[model samples]
Target: MAIFTIDDVEKTFKSGDVSEKILKGVDLALNEGEITALVGPSGSGKSTILTIAAGLQKATGGQVLFEGKDMTQMSQEEIRKIRSSEFGFVFQSSHLVPFLTVEDQLLLMLDVAETKLNKKQQKQEVSKVLDLVGMSHRKDAYPSSLSGGEKQRVAIARAIIHQPKMLFADEPTASLDSKRSKEVMEIIRNLTKTLKITTLMVTHDEEMLPYADRIVMMKDGLIE
Candidate 1:
């Protein structure tokens, strides 16, 4: 079933009487428990649609429906509430805090999501997520001490620790080498399957397309 739907989405940026249209009537849908890969060259607006669907940005024209509720109609505070509780994100960079331990990172995500877990339960959840990402041994290590793959693992752990219904990944493996990229993609696929999390991923790497259940190609600001 379709869990999220984008209907004729359009985005325009205006500066000094000049307007650029990034998205021109793009439409797509993301199914439940499936990974949808958005692929395109630069300037194709792949990332723009991803961010708009994820509520990180707004569409100038369209209906973004999540679970049948129109996100485009929601206020900033309402959208923020949904983002904190229902959506998880992975970016090109791990974006981990340099000072926080690996376990502490997941714990912080739980807090930000307002998961309502007690202190002890929160710790246990952290341990479980770390194990899932194969970072259990590095739970006490800070980001600076970890390798690139390890940091991305922790970032994935932190993302899913809140049990979000949707995962938005933007060039998640762009910073890693081929081996590490495949490893990270495998982890993301496995976790998304096991947890039944619907994922919308934007990636330019052709090598990673096989990992996604569906591939959407974009060109000239439209699905092609």
Candidate 2:
């Protein structure tokens, strides 16, 4: 079933006298436990739609429904709560805290998500997620000491540590080479499927498209 829906969504940017419409009546659905990839040329609004659905940005018009809740109608606090607790995100950059170890990073996410697990339970959860991303051994390593791929793996582990209901990934493998990119994609697919987390990703890599369960193409701000 569709846990998330975008209905006639529109986004526009205005600069003084100039106005540009980025998304024109976009309608899409993200189903339960599936990965959906949004693909389009630059400026086609794929990333805009992803952020809108993720609650990182607002739609100029129409509804962004999460589990049937109209997010566009929600207050900022309400939207922020959902984004922090129920959603996960992975970006092109690992974006890890330079000072934190792999395990500490996951712990920080739990703190941010307001997870109710005790310290021991949180540590166990961190270990499990690290193992999921094949980063268990590097749990004590800081970001600076890790390779690019390892850092990204740690980022993935941190993203899912709180067991978020939805995952939003934007060009998650763009910083890696072909081998590392494939590895990262496989980890993302396997983790989301195994944990039954719904995912929406915006990616330009054709090689990564095969990992997504559905591919939605966009042109001129509309799904094609």
Candidate 3:
């Protein structure tokens, strides 16, 4: 079943008297436990659509549905709550805390999401996710000491630590080398399958297409 859907979504930006339309009537549906990749050249609105569906930005027109509820209609507080709990994000950079240990990053996410797990349970959950991302050995290491791939692995661990129902990855592999990129994608794909988390990702790397279960091509603010 589709856990998330974006219907006829449109986004327009205005500065002074100038206006630009980033997304124009785009539609998409992401099924449970599947990875949907949005691919296109720069300025194609791929990232805009991802951000809109993730509730990070407002859509000028149309609906963004999460489990049949229209996200566009939700209040800012409601959206923030959902963004903190049900959804997870991985950006182009690992975006980890340079001073925080790997384990602390996941701990912070659990705290932010207000997960039901107690301190001990939260630590255990962190361990499990770290193992999944192959970063268990580096749990106590700070981000600054880790390699790029290790940092990304910890970032993935942090993203999934809350066991969110959906994950949004924006150019997740953009900062990695080819080998590291493939490895990172493997972890993401395996986690989505094993945890049944629906994922929508924006990636410019054509080589990464194989990791996605569905591919949506966009151009000039519309799906093509």
Give the alpha carbon lDDT tens digit for every residue of 98-215 in model 1: 8999988899999989998999999999998888999999999999999999999988998899999999999999999999999999999999999999999999999999999999
What are the per-residue Cα lDDT tens digits for candidate 2 across 1-224?
A: 99999999999999999999999999999999999999999999999999999998899999999999999999999988998899998998999999999999999999999999999999999988988999999999999999989988998888888899999999999999999999999999999999999999999999999999999999998999
Q: How many residue pairs clash in each candidate?
A: 0, 0, 0
- Tell me which residue pairs clash in candidate 3: none
Model 1 lDDT at residue 190: 96
- Alpha carbon deviation, residue 118, candidate 2 (Å): 0.5
For candidate 1, give the lDDT of residue 81: 92
- Tell me the deviation in Å of residue 178 in model 3: 0.3
What TM-score does candidate 3 reach? Answer: 0.98
List the candidates' TM-scores in order: 0.98, 0.98, 0.98
Cα displacement (Å) at residue 114, model 1: 1.0
Query: How do the residues 37-140 of candidate 3 rate in per-residue lDDT, one tens digit apiece?
Result: 99999999999999998899999999999999999999999999999999999999999988899999999999999999999999999988998998889889
Reference-based lDDT, residue 223, model 1: 99
Off-target runs (Cα >4 Å) in candidate 1 are none
Estimate the overall C-alpha local distance difference test score of candidate 2: 0.94
Ranked by lDDT, the better of candidates 1 and 2 is: 1
Model 3 lDDT at residue 182: 99
Candidate 2 stretches with Cα past 4 Å from truth are: none
